[model samples]
Target: MFRKNFIMSLMENILILFIIASVFYTSQSLQTQKTIYVPQGSITNIISQLHKKGYEVSPIDRYILSFLGQPQSGWVDIGAEKLNRVDFLYKLATAKAKMEEITLIPGETALLFFEDIASTLDLDASRLQHYYDQHADYPEAGIYADTYYVPFGINEEQLIAFLLKESTGQFQKISQKIYGTYDKKQWLRILTIASIIQKEAANTEEMPLVSSVIYNRIKKGMPLQMDGTLNYGKYSHIKVTPERIRNDKSRFNTYRYKGLPPSPIGAVSFDAIIAAIKPAQTDYLYFMKNRQGTHDFTKSYRTHRRNIQKAR
Candidate 1:
C-alpha cells in the first residue's frame, strides 16, 4: 500500500510539472513582430520600456549590457522582426540609418540647384549653397550630376563631405581616363569649354559639333562670337537679343573676349565634358540653330551669314 501511494504522488507531481511547462510554451509561442521605437532617453528607462514591449530584458541581460555597452539614440527593430535584442542593438549602433535619395540636375548652376536639393531634403537653402561654395574648388561645376542616397537625418556637414568626396573621386577617375592625369588647371579649362558645349548644344547628339566650332574658333584666334557665352547670371536665355549681344560688356561675353571664359558658366554633363576632350574633326567655325531644334554647322562666314538670312 505504501508503494502505491508513493507512485500516485509522483504521478501528480509530473502532471503539475507538465502543466507549468505547457503554460510557458504557450506564452513563448505567442511571440510576434512589433515595430518599437526607442527614443533618446535614459538607458535604464529605455531598457525597461523595451522589456514591457516584449524583449527578454532580465537582470542578467542588463548586467551583460553594462559590460557590452548600449547603442546611441536610434530606432531599433527587435523581438518579432526576426532579430534578437543583441542583433538589433549591434545594427543600430554600427550601421547607417534608413536612407533618402535625390537626383542632381545636369547643367544647372550649383548655387541654384542646391536650393532645389535643400527643398527636397528640407534643409536650409542658403546653408546648402554656402556649403557648396566653401568646399568646391570649382564651385558650381564641382559636383557630378547623379542620384545620391544619403542617410536619413544627416546634417549639412556630412552631406557636404559626401558631395566633395564623390565629386573629387569622379573627376579624378574621368580626368585620368581622358587626359592621363588629374591636371587641375587643364581640368578646369576643359570644364570651361564643356560648360559652353553643354549650354549651346540642343541635345547630347549636337554637343560634338558645337564643341568643334568652339575649338576651331580658338585655333584660328578668332573671337568665339557664340551667343551662348552671354547666357549667365540674370541674363541666361536660349536666344541672345541683338542689343544684349552687342552692348553687354561682361567678361563672359565671348563676342568681346577672344578665348574661353574665366571659368565654367554652369555645371556640365558627362557627354559635354567628353565632347570638349574629343571634338569632331570638322573645319566648322560657326553653328546656327535651325527650325528642326538642332544646329547647322558652317565652315565659312559667308555660308553662316546666308543661313542666318534664310532663318530670318
Candidate 2:
C-alpha cells in the first residue's frame, strides 16, 4: 500500500510539471511580420522553415498545430506584429491573407501593368518582368484585361504564374465555348485584331464598327495605317507623329507593312475580342477622329478627308 501511494504521488508531481512547462512555452512572445507567405509542406517542414526565417517556432509547434488544423498555403495574415506562441500557431492554421485589388484597364500594355503591380505590391519590377518573360507564351496580352485580387505578400514569380495560368484557362474556356475548340495560333490572330480594336474604339459600342473597317481594309489590300498600331510597348500613351510613321519600318507600323501586326499591340477586353470574331457587315475602309471624340467611319477617302478637315 505504501509503495503504491509513492508511485501515485510521483505521477501527480510529473503531471503538474508538464502543465507548468506548457504554460510557460505558450506564453512566450513571438515576433513576426503582419503578412507572411507559407509554402505548401508538412507541419514539421513548415515549423523548420519558420525557424529558418528567424521565427521562434519549433518541433513543439508541429504538435500544437496538429490539433489546430492544417496550415494554409500561400500568403497568410498574422494580424499582429507580436503574438504569444499559441496565438501565432493558431493564426498560421486559420487566418486568411489580406487581399488587394488590381485592375488592368483594357488597352494598357503589359509593361505598364507590371510597373503598376510592382509599385502596388512593393516588389521588384524587373523580377516581375523576368518571371513574365519566362512563363508567357506570347510577348504581350497573355493576361486578360480585367480586375484581379491577389494576396498582399505574393512574390513576383507566383503572381506572374497565377495571372498567366488563370488567363490561359479563361482563354481556353471562351474559345471552346464559342468555336467548339481552342486553337492557340488562330486565337492569337484574333487577339491581335482585338488589341487593335481596343486601342482605336472610343467605347464598347464602337468596337464592331472598327473591326469591320479592319476587315474591309485588309480585304481591299489597303494598309491599316492606324495610329493605334504605333502605340505599342513603351509608346502606349505617346502620340503617333508624322516622323514616327515615316521612320518606323517594323511590322507594327501598318503603313510600312501589310496584314495585321505580328502580335497583339496591347491588352484587349472581351468586348474587343468578340467584335474581332464577328465584325459589323459594312464596307467601311477608313475612320478619322471627329470633334465629338469618336470616329467617323466611311468607305470613301473623300468623305474621310472631309471629316479630318472638320476635326482640325
Candidate 3:
C-alpha cells in the first residue's frame, strides 16, 4: 500500500511540474506578441527616443540595420512605419532595397520637389535640401525630367550620383546609335537648349521639329526669342508684356543673350535631350506659341508673320 502511495505522489509532482512549464511557455509567447510591434524608430537619431519610450532594442543593432539598409533605412522616407514588428521591418528593408517610382511634374519648384519626396517616402526634406544646397554641382547634369524609380533609403547625394551615372550611360548609347560621337561640351549645350525647349513645347510630336527651329536660328546667328527663358527670371507670375520681355536682364533671357543660357532651366527629359541631339531636318527658322500650347512653325518670315496675325 505504501509503495502504491509513493508512486501516486510522484505522478502528482510530475503533473505540477508540467503545469508550471506550460505556464512559463505561455507567458513568454504573450510577452513576445505584446512587444513585437515596439517602435524602434524610423529615424536613427530617434532610437534613443524609442528606447525612452520602452522599446527594447540595442542601438548597435539599429545602426547595423540602417547601415545595411542604407538608402532605405533611417532616412527621410514616405510611408507609414510601425515600430518593432519583424514582418513590417522586413518589408520595409526589402522595399528600401528596391526601386520606387518618383514623379517630378512640370511647374514644380525646388521646395515642392522636397515635399513630394517626403510625402511619398517619409524622408526628411530638410536633410535632403541641405545636401542639395551643399552639392549643387552634383545634380547639375543628367537628372532626367521624368518619373524615375530610385532605390529606397538612399541619401540625396547617392540618388543624384545614380541619376548622373544612368544619364551618362543613356547618353553614350544614344550618341553611339545616332551621331556616333560623344562630346561633353557639345552635349551640355544641347541639354541646355533641350531643357528650354522641353518647358516651351506643348506637343511631343513637335519636340524634334521645334528643336530643329532653334538649331536653325542658332546657326543663322539670330537671337532665340524664347519666352520661357524670360519667365525663369521673375519670382512672381506675370503676364508676358513687351516691357518684361525687353527689359529682363537675367542670363536665361535668350532674347537678350546671343547664345544658349548659362545652365539648364530645369531637368531635361530623355525625349527632349534626344530630340535636341537629333533634331528633324527642316528649314524652319521661326516658331511661336498660341493661346493653346501648340506652336506654329514657319520656314519664312512672311509665313511666320501671317500666322502671328491670325493668332492675334
Candidate 4:
C-alpha cells in the first residue's frame, strides 16, 4: 500500500512539471507575429480572439491570460516572432497605437481645411466639418497654423478639442509677445485686420503696410474700398469688379460699406496677425500692386490713379 502511494505522488509531480512546460512553450511561440485588434470587451472576447488567431490555447490557459489584463481597444502591432503568454498579455493590455501627423495651411477656409484633416485621419469629413460649424464659437481668423499629431482611434470631438487646445496655446504665446493686453473686442478687430493683410499682402514685408491701409481708413472714416473684403462667400477676389461692387449690397462690400467686415475672411498667419496689431507708421492710405509683385504705397488718390493706369 505504501509503495502504491509513493508511485502516485511521483506521477502527480511529473504532471505538474508537464503543465508548467506547456504554458512556457505557449508564451514563447506566437503562431505568427501580426497586428491584433483587441477591442474593448470582456475576457471572453479576448479568449475567442486567441482561438480565432490559430492559437491552440486551452481553456485554462485562456483564463490565465485574460485574467492577467483587461482588453485594450486599438491596433497593436505584435512585432515578436513568438509571444510567450506573458508578452502577449502585456501587449494586448497596452494600447500602443501609431500617430498620424498633419499640417494646417494659412488662408484656408474652415470648411475645406477641416475636410482635408478628416480625410488624412481616415475619418468622416462631413462629420468633422459639421462638428466644427456647430460647436466652435470662435472665427477661423486667428487659428495658428502648424503641424499636429493625432493618435489612432481618436474620435472627431477629441480631435477638435486637441486642435483647439493647441491653437489656443499658440495664440496665447503670440498674444503675450504682440498684443501685450488681453481685450476681446480689440483682438477681434485685430483678427479682422490681420485676415485682410493675409489676403492682400504679397509677402511678409508688405503685411504691415497693408495693415496700415486698413487702420488709416478706419481712423479717417473713409470707405475701406478693399477688394479682399469683398472676396467672401461663394465669390472671392474674382468678384470684386466695378460691376459687382455697384450691384452687390452685402456688409462685406468694403467699397460701399464703412469700417471692417463682419468677420475675418479666413485664417491669418502669425506674421499677418502681428502686423495688424502694430502697423507701419505710414500716412499712406492707398496701395496698388506694382509690376514687381510688391505694392506701391501712396498718400494721394492722384498717385493711386496713376499707379492704376500704369498697372493697366
Candidate 5:
C-alpha cells in the first residue's frame, strides 16, 4: 500500500508540472498576438502607448528591458522584425534597440533632403535646416552632395555633422584616387565646378564630355556659358527661360561671367567630382542637348553654331 501511495504521488506531481507548463505556453502565445509601435518616446510612454494599442505589456517591463540592468544584447537582439503577434511589446522593445535607417538619394537638394529626413525619421525639417544653415559651412553653395545613410533618433546637428564627415571622407578618397593627393582647397574649387557641370549635363553619359568642354573653354579664357547657372540664380528650379538666359547679370550667369561662378549651383555626384578633377582629354568646347538625352559636341565655333541651330 505504501508503494502504491508513492506511485500515485509521483503521478500527481507530474500532472501539476504539466499544468504549469501549459499555462506558461498559453501566456507566451497571447503575448505573440499583439503589435506595438514605439515612436520617439520614453520607455514609460512607449509602454503605455503599446498597452493602449492592445498589447500585453507593462511599464516596468519596458523600464527593465530598456534601462534597469538588462543586458544590452538581450534588449537589442530583437533585430528588425514585423509585429504580427499580440505580445508585440517584448518584440518591439527588442526591435526598438535595432538601428533604424534613413537614405538620402542623389540630386536631393537641402530642402528636399531635410523633408525626407523629417518624414522618414520623424524629425523636424525646419529645425534641421536651420541647424545646417547655421552650423554647416561649405566652400561654396551646395558643396556637399551625395547619398547618405543616417540612423534613427539623430538630431539636426548630428545629422549635419554626419553629412559633413561623409563629404570630407569622400573628397579625400576621390582626391587620392584620381589626383594622387588630397588638396581640400583645390578640390573644393573643382567640386564647385563639378556641381555646375552636374546641373548642366543632360545625362550621366554626357557628364565627362560636358566636363571636358567646360575645361577646354576655361583653358581658352572663354565664358563657360552654362545656362543652368543663370537658371539657378534667377529661377527657383533648374528650368532655363529665354528671357533669364538673355538678361544675365547675376553672378551665377556663367554666360556673362568669365570664370567659375562664385559658388556651386546644386548638389553634385561623385562622378561629377571625379570628372571635374580628371576631365576627358578632348578639344570639344561646346555641347547642346538633343531629344535623345545626349549632347551634340563641337570642337569649333562654326560647328557649335550649326549644332545650336539644328537643336533649335
Candidate 6:
C-alpha cells in the first residue's frame, strides 16, 4: 500500500514538471520578417529551412506545426516582427502574403517610377527616395525596368532594399554570362550608352543602328547632339526644345558635353543593353529623321542636310 502511494506521488511530480516545461516553450519568442518565403515542403523540411535561416526553430517545432495545419507555400505574411512561439507557428501555417504589381517601363526615369509607385502602393515618395538613397549602389537604374509582384504593405526601406537586391543579382548574372565578370564602372558606361539607345531608337530593330551612331560620334570626338539626352529625370516626357537645350547646363546635355552622359539618361531595355554591348558594323556617321518617321543613315554631312530638309 505504501509503495502504491509513493508511485502516485512520483506521477503527480512528473505531470507538474511537464506542465512547467510546456508553458516555457510556448512563451519563447521568435523574430520574423513581415513577409517570409516558405518553400513547398513537409513540416519537417519547413522547420529545417527555418532553422537553417537562423530562426529559433527546432525539430520539436515540427511536431507542434503538424497539429496546426500544412504550411503555406510561397510567401507567408508573419504580420509582426516578433511573436510568441505558438503565434509564429500558427501564422506560418495559416497566413498568406498579399501582393501588388508594379511596372517600370523602359526609358522611364527613377523620379517618375517612384512617383508611380507612391500612387499605386500608397507609400510615401520622400521615404522611398530616402531608402533608395540609403541603400542603392547607383543613383538610378538600381532596379530593373520590369514588372514586379511585391508584397503589399511593405514599408519604404524594405521595398527599396528588395528591389535593389533583386536587380543587382540579375545584373551580376547577366554581366557574368557576357564577360565572365562584373565590373561596376564598366557596366555604368555600358548603361550610359544603353539608356541613349533606349530613348533614341524608334523600335527594337533600330537599337543597334542608334548604338553605332553614338560610337562613331564618340570616336570622331563630335558632340552627341541627340535630343533624347534632354529627357532625363522629371523631363522624361517633356519635348526637348532648342531653348531648353541651350539653357540646360547639366552633364546630361550631350550637345554641350563632348562624350557620354556622366550617368545613364534613364532606365534601359534588354535590347538596348545588348545593342550598346555589340553595335552594328557601319561607316555611316550621320542620321536624320525622314518623313516616314524612321532615321536615314548617311556618311556625308551634305546628304544628311538634304535628308533633314526633305524630312521638313
lDDT winner: 2
Q: Write the per-residue lDDT of candidate 5 for residues 1-312, one digit (tens) a residue.
A: 999999999999999998886556435533332222354456666667657877665654564456432222212334334432323434554453335455544444566667777887778989877777776555333335654545545677887777777777777787787778987667668867787777778777778888898888988999998877663422536577777777768787887788887766656787777778778889998887776767899898899888878777
The candidate maximizing TM-score is: 2
Model 3 bad stretches (over 4 Å): 1-53, 56-101, 106-141, 150-154, 179-182, 233-239
The residue-by-residue lDDT of candidate 1 on 217-273, one tens digit each, is: 999999988776777644544468888878889878988889988888777778988
| TM-score for predicted model 3 compared with the true structure | 0.66
Clash tally for model 3: 15
Better of 1 and 2 by lDDT: 2
Q: Flag the better candidate by lDDT, 2 or 4.
A: 2
Query: What is the Å distance of residue 201 in model 5 from its true position?
Result: 2.0
Candidate 1, TM-score vs. the true structure?
A: 0.71
| TM-score of each model, paired residue for residue | 0.71, 0.84, 0.66, 0.73, 0.72, 0.72
Clashing pairs in 2: none
Cα lDDT tens digits for candidate 3, 1-312: 999999999999999998886455323311112122223346464455545655444465455456445224333332343433433333334443345688765433344566678778777777666666565542233455567787555676776566556667777787777778887777778777777677678867888988998889989998888776654422323456788777878777787887777766665666777788789999998887676868888899999898898778
State in Å the error of residue 190, model 5.
1.4
lDDT of 4: 0.75
Q: Model 1, residue 168: displacement in angstroms?
A: 1.2
lDDT of 6 by residue, 3-78 (tens): 9999999999999999999889978998988888787789999999989988998998999899999987777778
Q: Is candidate 4 or candidate 5 better by TM-score?
A: 4
- Could you tell me how far off, in angstroms, the CA of residue 26 lies in candidate 4 after the best superposition? 5.6
Higher-ranked by lDDT: 3 or 4 = 4
* Residue 97 local lDDT, model 4: 64
lDDT string, candidate 2, 1-312, tens digits: 999999999999999999999999999999998888787899888999989989989898999999999988878878899999999999999988678898888999989898988999998888988998899877889899999998877799989999999888888888998999999898899899999999999999999999999999899888998989998988999999999999988889999998899999999899999999999999899899888899899989999899989999
User: What lDDT does model 2 reach?
Assistant: 0.91
- TM-score, cand. 6 vs. native: 0.72
Model 4 deviation from native, Cα RMSD in Å: 4.9
Evaluated at residue 292, the lDDT of candidate 6 is 79
